[model samples]
Structures are given as structure tokens and as C-alpha cells.
Target chain A: MEDDYYSIESILAENQKIQCTFKIDVPDMGHLDGGNERDIKALSKVQVPLWMAYILIYSDYADFTIPPPFSARVRSALNAEARSVRLSNLVGQAGLWYGFGRMIMRLLNDDVAKEMSDVLVKTFRDRLPEVIDQAQHFASVHASSADSGVGGDNATMLFREGLDGTERELFALAQDSTRRTKRWYETSERGRRS
Target chain B: MALPTPLRASVTPAELELIASEQLVEIVPLVAMERTAFISGAYGPLRPPTKCKVPIWMATNLKLKKKCRVVPPDWLNVEFLEGRLTQETSEAGFSEMPFRFAEVAKVLLDVAPDDFPNPDKIRSLLKDIREARQAKSREGLSKLDHSELSLPNLCSMEINEIRPFFIRAMGVLTDLVKEAQPQQDAP
Candidate 1:
């Protein structure tokens, strides 16, 4: 639980940094960042909030470097061992991660984003059966143990029961992902503000 | 004002309202309105004596306008809810109910309690169902402290009912995690 909390917090911090991080070619924005240099070729990476990033991305004035967990590393991880990793954080903060990734994918048409989306879908579908099996088995064993007195044949399963809500939490996260995905298509027909 | 409840899952009256909006309500129209539209798609041509499938909102509006008499959902009856409560207790499960049961019941009972022979019976049954479910959730919560590694399958309503208990359990679990963290970090 502590590890999850720490990892989630660290992930959140990284996301926050990314939200305020980007590379823009605009000159007016540099003056706001307290830089004295007013040269035309002084283009450098700057950290700005996502709201500003959207305008830059939309105007085709800036290039968004794909942040961590949405990178090729995660794609390789999915191809390797997706289960050991906490995939819920990928769709972090009520679909912020997925929504942003999707928006970036659409805006840039980056193949990396495309691959990430494919791997996410595949990984989620693959993980579903195992998660359901574990959840149901854990639930039944817990129920039976409660019914019985001391111990049961499924004593081995009891160790997995108190899993800090990984399965159910992921279940909810997956549902949120589905909903966000639908909204993406529904509202994407509009010019990307919805 | 009641305290807002903490929940593990996102379930609320809003979901019930979503279900309620799709429910088939029986309405007998007094004023003939030909296929009217009201946000949630087109519905109408409400004719009297010929019962039609109207959404709950349309039925409510018709009832409010003194146009059509809204035949409350069949499950809204006192006897039915009492049966549901019994079933909920005996089977440790619930039968499918009309969405927004509590909200709709309160609306109907508040507006036209006289339609039923004993309105208080229905209210009491709803109260009992609520109380019993809350109590059942509390039972699961009470045992949470005894075992650190137990996961309980709580329905949405039960989760809402056990909000405070859930917070307490979370606090305990957080402390436990904190206690375990240092040892693991000490390599």
C-alpha cells in the first residue's frame, strides 16, 4: 500500500512537471519567463501549463516531447511484463493521462502514441481475465473462510485477499478509461475542444 | 446537512437518475400533445385511455400539468418494497428494482400519499431497507480492524453507507503501511 501510494505520488509529480513542461518556438513567451535574451533564434524548451500547451500544439508552434510512461519504454514494457507494472497510473487522475495521450496522438499523429494506444488496449484486454479470475477467487475464498470456522483448503489464497484494492481499483480505472474513450470519439468530431 | 460520503466506487443517485430516465412509465394523457420533444429525444402523441410508454420525466410533467395521471411503477407499492427488503435480507442479494426507487418513492409519496391505503407502510419499508443495508455494511466494517488482509465486496449503496467506516479503515491501513514501510526501506 505504501509503495503504491509513493509510486502514485511520484507519478503525479512527474505528470505535474510534464503538464508545465514543453518546447515552444515562440519569442513572447520567453520574455515572460524572465530571460533577458530577445534573439530570434533563442528557441529553447520551456515548461508551461497544459492549457497553454494546447494553444501551442493547436497552432503548430510547439513540439510536445512524449513524457514518461507514454514513451517507447512503456511500449517495450507492455511487450515484456505488463502485469508487474501498475498500469492504472497510466490512466491517472480521472483519465487525465489517457485523455492527454489521446489528444497528443490526434494532434501530432505520432506513431509512438499510436503504438501506445494499441498496446494499452491489448494489455487491458489481456489483464482483464486474470484480474477477474483473481478477484472472484479471492472473493469466494474470503466468503467461504467466513462461513467456516478456523481454516479452509484455500488458506494459500488468503494471502492475496488483502491486496490494497488493486483489482477493484483497476476495475474502476478501466471503466473510467472506457468512458473517457467514448467521450473522445463523441466529442472529437468537433474541433478538439470538447 | 448530512456529511458527504466517501466511496471506493463512483455510484450515486445520478446513476439511478440515468436509469430512471430510460424507465417506461405508464401515462394516460388528458391533453393531446403530438410527439413533443424534451431534451432526452422525442416522445408524445399522448392520447387518453390508451396507455403509452413515456419516460419518467414526461410522466412527471404530465402529472404536474394535471394532464395525465401517472401510474406509479408497479414496484413502488408498499407490499413490493417490503418483499424486496425480505429478499435482500434472506438471500443477501437484491432483486432488480425500479431505478431511483427511493427518490421516486419520496416524490410520489410526497405528492400523492392518499393514493395508497397506507402510505406510511411504504415509507417505513424504505427506511427499513436503508437501515438494514447500512447495518450490514457496518458489520463488514467492524470486522475490518480485526484482519488487515480482508477485502469485502460492497455494493454502491452499501459503500455509500459505510463512508465513515471506510475512512477509518483507510486510516488504519495507511498507518499499517507506514509501519511496514520503514523496515522494507531499511536495506
Candidate 2:
């Protein structure tokens, strides 16, 4: 019969020195239901180094350099395939509000976060018509160009023409996830305020 | 089979060659002076009163191409280049250094019109400076020694003093554009 349990005694180990790089101060929680005994506990604290934060922020999109992962690849491919759709131009307008929503959430609660997320989603959805119209116009302009060979009639075609249904669904899912994160942050803030 | 003989062609009539004349525009390159000669009155006892040089580059158009010519007669002696203005004297081993074009633009753009000779001229000068720097950079190599480059002291000054100037300049430019829009809209 095979042995069911692994013994820690048989495991090899090496001793190493560990040094703490950062210190975080947490509020002391006094003892609850104590019988004339003073007990103080420190709240849990996590320390993230400046270098690490810089790396994480710079490395990933939707932070500073690039849009969220969902929009990044889509935007790049679209830009390459069609010259008229400039993904960067949308950032200062719609993306700025989206970022604000995210910031408000991280500073606040889950419920308020969700509400903010809903607001952002609704805003984006409302603007979707304009966005689609702009995209179509750009496509037509490119298609009309002599080098494009594509006719103006086919220029207004959306990503659905090239991408499968699953891919389009995935993009929608990613966008929803981004919105939910923002909503969660807003909710957290509202909870704190209440 | 034998090859057939080639037929000879004959000139039927004399034709007149018409030449079209068009005006050729001659592009004249603009020469702008760069670099400033500063005569500082003795304020400190460390060294005798001396003349310090500030190098400047002015960007101008040469026909179809934009060219940058170095201004301020003795820029190499001043040891000024882009990027390294903020380093302390102790760290940099120099009392003064040159600032980047961006930094200089930020400073000049910040200075109040009341304090400077001519604010608009200064702004233009700063733009030319920036253009020159950019043109030089795009040339694939830097003219100055990279290791010795430094930023000017003016840029390292308080941001508050400089920030408002840029805002004002931007506002003025925006107003100009707004004013021009109506004329453009007119039939």
C-alpha cells in the first residue's frame, strides 16, 4: 500500500536570513469581551515597495501607458487594419472618466463602487453610437483611399466581420470585468461614508 | 526565309517647341543668433567677477528642410547640454550647468512679461530653442558630450513662478485661435 501522508521530518530545509524592508502602522484594536484584561491587537498591514508599484503600473495597461487589456489588442489590430480609428484619441475623453471611476472606487466601498461602475457603463453605452459612427466614417475614408482597394460601401463594416462570435463575446466580458472592478471600488467608498 | 527590308520615315513638316515658363521661388534660410553672454557683478568672494556664457540654438527653415544652427558663439566652453540641471553642485562638481530645451522652454514660458524684455519674443525664442534641440536630436547623434551635459539653473527654480506664465501664454494662444475661428467661419 502506498503511503497516504507526507512527513515534514523527512523534508530538506535550508536556513536563511530575512530582512524587513518596510514598516506599516496599523491602529490598535482593544480586546473585546475581556474580563479586566487589557489586550491590544494590530490590524493586518501589507507593504508594497515604490519600485514594485512603479513596475506593476508601468508593465500593465489600463494604468498609465496603455488601455486595459481588452481594448489594447483590439485597438492595435483595428488601427493596423484601418488607419482612421485612432485608439489614443479616445483616452483623454471617455478613458479619463473611466479612470476617475476606478480611482473613486479604490478610495471608497463595494456598493458605491458598483454604482459608479454602472454609471461608467451607461456613459460608455450612451456614447457607443457616436463611437460606432466615428469608426464607420473612418473606415469609409480609408476604403476610399486608392491604396486600400476596399470600396467605401464595405468600409463601415465592424469588427464582427473579421472576428468570430466567441472573440467578440470575450471582448465584452473583459469590458464588463473592468467596469465591475470600478464599481466595486465605488461601492467600498460609499460603505465607508455611510 | 529572307528578312524583309526596313522602311525609312520622312519628316513631313517643321514643328514649333513651346516652352512653358513658371516662377521658381527661392527659399532663403533664416539665421538666428543663439547663446547669451552674461557679465555677472561680483556677489560672492569665492572667485573674481567673470563672464559666463550660455549656448543657444535657433531652428529655422532652409528651403524644404528645417535646419538648426547653434547660437551663442561659445557653447562648447559653457559645457551646457540637455538633461542634468537638478544635480547639486556637490554631486555634479559644477556651479552652473545647461538645462534641456524642454526645461528651458518651461522656464521662459513661466517668466512674467513684466519681468522679461518681451514675453512674446521670449516665447518665440524658447520655441526656436526647442525646435533646434529636436532637430539636432533627430540627426541620429548629439553634438555635445553626453557625459558632461547638464540642465540650466533657471529651470530648477520654483515651479510656482514658472507655471502661471505657461498658463497665461496658453490662454493667450487659445484666445487668438478663438478669435480667428469666426473669420474662418465667415463666407
lDDT of 2 by residue, A59-127 (tens): 331122222312445434443543234322333211222333333333224454454444434333333
The recovered share of true contacts, given per candidate in order, is 0.00, 0.00
- Alpha-carbon local distance difference test for all models: 0.49, 0.28
TM-score of chain B for predicted candidate 2: 0.23
Candidate 1 residue A194 Cα shift, in angstroms, is 34
> What DockQ was computed for model 1?
0.02
Task: Look at candidate 1 and give me any clashing residue pairs.
Answer: B35-B45
Summarize candidate 2's per-residue lDDT along B1-187 as a digit string, tens digits.
Answer: 2432110111111100000001111112233333334342221111112222222111111211332211222222112322222233124232233333233333222321233444455455444443343232222111122122233343222212222222222222222121212221221
Q: On residues B24-58, what C-alpha lDDT tens digit does candidate 1 reach at each position?
A: 67766778778877677787777777777788656
Could you tell me which 10 consecutive residues in candidate 2 chain B have the lowest summed lDDT?
B12-21
Candidate 1 residues lying further than 4 Å off, grouped into runs, are A1-194, B1-22, B89-99, B114-117, B143-158, B163-168, B171-187
**lDDT tens per residue, model 1, A22-93:** 344454445644577563233466555444566666655656676675777777876786554554465543
Give TM-scores of chain A for all candidates: 0.52, 0.28
